[model samples]
Target: MAIEHADVLRAAHLARLGIDDADATRYVGDLSRILEMVDALQGVDTEGVAPLAHPLDATQPLRADEAIEPDRREAFQACAPSVSQGYYLVPRVVE
Candidate 1:
């Protein structure tokens, strides 16, 4: 796929990016190369290949699911200026 100067300018305009003539020319070449590489990659045969979640075969060690801290909801709520039905109440700022 070839990336033209007009395509670069249109993309830049749509993305609200400021690109000068020199930069746009450079980007046209860069984008053309990228698209050509993508086209090349699309030609590869991988009919029997299974998708990989990770490249390396590794397992993450996980800690046991257990609570270590004591529940102190009432203790903390006692310091709040306003609390109702186990919920902190703040002054209404919106209509």
Candidate 2:
């Protein structure tokens, strides 16, 4: 799966990249190597291997979902400039 010069140019064009002659050659070599590696991987035998959600088999420690602060909505809303029907009112700025 060797990437050619035309393929590199086309990829660059599709990606909206401004690659010059030297960069295009470098990209072609790098992309070709990457494709070769992927091709090699496709030939590998992974029949018995189980899929893993995470690389490490460890459970994450989490804190209990309990309320740590008391409800103080009324105390906080008392400092607002205007509030009615448990809702804050603001001046109408737009139609």
- Tens digits of per-residue lDDT, candidate 2, 1-95, equal 87899999999999999999899989888999999988987787889988777988898999999899898879999999999998888997697
Q: Pairs clashing in candidate 2?
A: none
Going through the candidates in the order shown, the clash numbers are: 0, 0
Cα-based lDDT at residue 3, candidate 2: 87
Which residue pairs does candidate 1 place in steric collision?
none
- Which candidate wins on lDDT? 1
Model 2 stretches with alpha carbons more than 4 Å out: 44-95
lDDT of 1 at 61: 80
- Residue-by-residue lDDT tens digits, candidate 1, 41-94: 778897998977888899778989888889899999999999999989999879
TM-score of candidate 1 relative to the true fold: 0.46
